[model samples]
Target: MSPANPVAGDERRRLVEDVIQRRILSTELRPGQRVNESRLAEELVVSRTPVREALLRLEGQGWVLFDHGRGFVVTPLSTDEIRETYPIVAQLEQLALTSTGPALRGLAPVLSEINGEFGASTDPARSHDLDARFHRTLASRCGNGRLIALLDRHWQALHRYERFYMTHPDDHRRSVRQHDAIVAAIASGDVASAADQLVDNIIGPMHVLLERLR
Candidate 1:
């Protein structure tokens, strides 16, 4: 029997979703930036239908807002939103680590790979991608699809701030050191220490970003 085709309409939708998400997260598509359907369709090399579908999905996720007559625009990252969301994210991430403590041994190779990537990366964008992948891998192991989905949504919302930090030279170095610490804690099976490191790593950058914004 032939292997099943992996690229289906669902795959197209996911691709479109990723394109819109990357643009928004990278701030290439900034807050209040209007999404032109035809232009995005051309840029993404997809039909307008898929682009529209992706925008609708983002709208539902609070990453985009549609006005009655204004169509869709990237949502602004309000200080209040960050204040409310980061704490919940911290709790969820800690819970995931605590729940998955037993399986963390399997994650050593992945952690090592991430460490190597972070150590070798000099480009801001590449470094941020590896950092995101490392955290997402950990969260995915929580084995709760709902929790993963929730965290994914929050991460999308927080990506703008993350990108800012990733591009800043000092913050980038500190971030790598923090990730190194978390990896060490996890590798040593110190769940409490890992959880503490996770919270500090997330909240520390967030606090700095908020202060800078203010």
Candidate 2:
């Protein structure tokens, strides 16, 4: 082979990361569980190098922790982390929506459509995706790069927690309603109200987890 393909290796590494990350988020790889490099490499049909690289990157993202040559273990979900992070995400999203300006005002129909899909979604994974798209669409227009990056980072944990919490029909309906309210607020050009909804929407479900952890 003429010079090992660096690009192929990078792509394979990303593929490993995506699959492993999904398992982590979906709880197939529960918190504190060990990650077996050999098992994963065989399962993924790639060499160990890419899998190892992917795990290292995920460690940087706080998704896992190294066990000092014993390989990586999935990081445990923390109520404290949720309590601290949700508010920060909420406040930053508020700022993003408020400063996003009037362009989003005209995007009501698009937002409403997404909310409808979210409500009608039957699959858990699909619902989670639609839910993210709904928020991402609105925040995409926020005109602030730094705020958006932070929101995306925090959302990694938030998405998994929300998925875990939104298992009941009641929870799903409630979330859909909250999403609708946020869309309506944006449509009416009331950034304050929309931002307010954003904060409450996040904290409402979070409060339940907090209670359970207590």
Candidate 3:
């Protein structure tokens, strides 16, 4: 028999990983749920090998954990995760903003436009997406690719938490107000103030999220 194609195998594994990660982010696969490799393989219409590979990848990314007796399980939600993840993201984003130097002012108009859309969005999911785009645009002018990449990694980990919080209209409104402050600071060329406001924007919701988890 011919050997399996490595390229095809890799694509299948990535496809499986994307589908499983999306489910986890969307909370379709709730925290602490057991991940059935065989069942997922059948559902995804792929073989067990790719499913196993994908689960291992997800494990590395902190989306799931491996257990000898129980197999893979979704990583449970915890206040500790929030405490650790939020500050790192806040600091990284602040550094990214400061690194933009004189060019940060140029991004204010774009940032304001995105924030306006985010405020008008009524759907939690839509709001979450727009909020992410607003942040991405805020940091777009920063020349440090490595900082952005690291920020994105931790930022993705916050998605489940952020998405959960977006359902509360009051909390989201606070975020919109914070975004406005950050934009105003940027437009005025007050890098220090903008960085402070940006940190507030990133870390403020964290308090509410932690309280909810507790």
Candidate 4:
């Protein structure tokens, strides 16, 4: 495979990265699965160079790991890793909510509408995307540029776990309920309470997965 246009190298790399990321998170490319650059180039209709560039970036993000002799493989995912990440993200999200204060009053209704759409959506991937959007919307109001950037980085890692949870019927129902509580707490300008709800919404599922792992 060769490049469509030399000038579009960066764009091709980015496109390949996003598709590969999605495939990994969706479990289409399972953990530890070896990546074939020539196959990817053929499948994605691009040159091997962009796939190489994309894998380099993904390796940096911990989405894939490269072996000097073996090229790249999807990184293993585990409940333990997600269990460690959820509480930290929850705390940061809470701090962001607190920083927003009364400015959050109007956001509840919008969140509620999104929550409704989330609950009704039967597509697991769409549901997962909506769930991330719900939190990212709140993160935007955190008013701390650096923290938002950090949270955004970790959010990508969290998506695979979130997608797992979205596949569980009981978990989806619980998510909707927790989202309601979170929205209500935020709408009332109770940052501490809203933060607590946020923590429960995230860490609760992680704990469930942990128990299952045990």
Judging by TM-score against the true structure, name the best candidate. Answer: 2
The candidate with the higher TM-score, 2 or 4, is: 2
Candidate 3 lDDT trough over 10 residues, lowest sum? 19-28
User: For model 4, what is the C-alpha lDDT against the true structure?
Assistant: 0.85
Candidate 4 scores a C-alpha RMSD against the true structure in Å of 2.6
Lowest lDDT block of 10, candidate 2? 159-168
Compared with the true structure, what per-residue lDDT tens digits does model 2 show for residues 99-161?
878787976789899999989987778888888888788788878888888889998767667
lDDT of 4 by residue, 1-214 (tens): 9656766888999999999988987889998898899999999999899999999999988899987777799887776688788888888887887788667877888899999998898888988988998898877776799889878887877777788788888888899899999999888888788888988898887887777656
TM-score of each: 0.82, 0.94, 0.93, 0.92
Tens digit of per-residue lDDT, candidate 3, span 1-214: 9998999999999999999887887788999998888988999899999999999988988889987789999999889989999999989988889999888898999999999999999998899999999988877889999988998899888888988889999999999999999999989889999899888887888899988888
CA lDDT of every candidate: 0.81, 0.85, 0.90, 0.85
Best by lDDT: 3
Task: Provide the lDDT at 43 for model 3.
Answer: 91
The local distance difference test score of model 2 is 0.85
| RMSD to true structure for each model, in Å | 4.3, 1.5, 1.6, 2.6
- Collision count of model 2: 0
In angstroms, how far off is 26's CA in candidate 4? 2.0
Off by over 4 Å in 4: 1-7
